[model samples]
Target: MSYVDLHCHLLPGLDDGAATYDDTLRHARRLHAEGVRDVACTPHVKRDEFPGVAVREIVERVAHAQRRIAAAGLAIRLHSGAELAHADALLLPASDLERIAQGPADARWLLLECPFDGIDDDFALAAARLRELGFGLLLAHPERSAGLLAGDGLARLRPLLAHGALLQVNVCSLLGNHGLDVQDAAVRLVREGVAFCLASDGHPGSREQTLQLGFHLLLRAGASSTQAYRLTQANPRLLLRDGVTRPLFDVEQRALAAAA
Candidate 1:
């Protein structure tokens, strides 16, 4: 029953995640005890505020944690990825985008975060641009986004999904740590089968964000054991192995070629 967390902030000094190396070690132990065998260190990449995490920095910190985990005999493995702010996706050049990408080095799964305040009218365009660049989009925590909570929320998300974007929900959202509305949204997304995965989005302060609790909560919310495992493990594993998702639109390789 090995689990993989596709979104987490376990690296120290990168963003609002773990504050130091010691904190990262503690997070690793907790995740290992909770039955997570692999984790993606998905720090923030909002260009205005957090911008993006540096690839070298992520590698260095992950190496440090791996050595410590080996010394402590923990079995957890680390992968690198970023939670891109929608604004950054539009502003960054393709080459710069490549540097901040998260996932296995061979894979191009970019975790994207929508605006918390609201979805910009042009947000869909930004998502399309990323997809055109050949990166698979894994949207992070749409249930927390105010835009997704209001109006025809599900309708608003349809274009992104149609464009082959996958949705990820935070564990905290399922457990009501974020609030009743967010919990409802998370549960609704899970129950409706709209969400492609569940993640800790864990950044050090909440018990509600553990992967183990999330797995059970999904079951309690109506997901069978196998379905829960697919969200937390199999689907993400497939993303890493396949490197690209089914394109939402007719893809023109010219964009990727030009970007390359």
Candidate 2:
């Protein structure tokens, strides 16, 4: 199956993602060429800086980008959603979370951002609250979290996973660009069957980096291609669906075999 990038900075002039419509178009073209059939335009909903960007505004902007892509005859489908920062969690009204939770192509999963600091009980409670309010959470790049990088990070995440939260690790982390400890943690997460997806939290200037490289890293680390595909493609597709929780073991086993 063609890949779908569940997390990306594709929307033009929204936050620090793509700076212009042309830049957006360029990224779309690149994604299509890389066989990315769908992409979520995950502009930052960081609480510290972009508080003014309401959920409705993000939806409209995403719709506008989709229109532009269609007009330009790009084969790739662009979906609108926000990479909502942890700080913006409670700040966004329940209604707004509902609106922003909409995925690129009729998807139900929300691409949630973790705080740069660490995951805490409050965050976990907030996530549970969101679930209670009927939104599926796809935690973005937890490998970057210092707590997750520490010895006991996985223990903390185990409960969240049981609570229907899916984990997303950035492709760059696998490359050790974030640091060896993070890379080790990211590998361990995949190897131990913790992370559900590996995405290229691709910025505008760094279009050359692809999730394919991350897939290779996972495979080399003993993940089967099927598992890698599931994390990089299948699971993400399901995530884009109605945010249903699925078993991770089968795919991880398949991915390990494929890697072998």
Candidate 2 Cα outliers beyond 4 Å, as residue runs: 103-107, 206-208, 245-260
TM-score of 2: 0.88
- For candidate 2, the C-alpha RMSD (Å) to the true structure equals 3.9
Q: Give all TM-scores, in the order shown.
A: 0.87, 0.88
Evaluate candidate 1 by giving its C-alpha RMSD to the native, one decimal. Answer: 5.9
- Cα deviation of 176 in candidate 2 (Å)? 1.3
Candidate 1 residues lying further than 4 Å off, grouped into runs, are 51-56, 102-107, 206-208, 247-260
Residue lDDT tens for model 2, 1-260 = 48878888887666777789888888788777777888877888876886556677887888888998888887877767788876677667887787777644333567778766777776777777777776767889888887785655656766667666778888888888888988887887788777888888888766446676767887976789889998888877776764544354344444444433
Candidate 1 residues 103-201, lDDT tens each?
555547688886677566667778889988887788888998885756555567677676677788888888888789888888877777677789999
Top candidate by lDDT: 1
lDDT per prediction?
A: 0.76, 0.75
**What is candidate 2's local distance difference test score?**
0.75
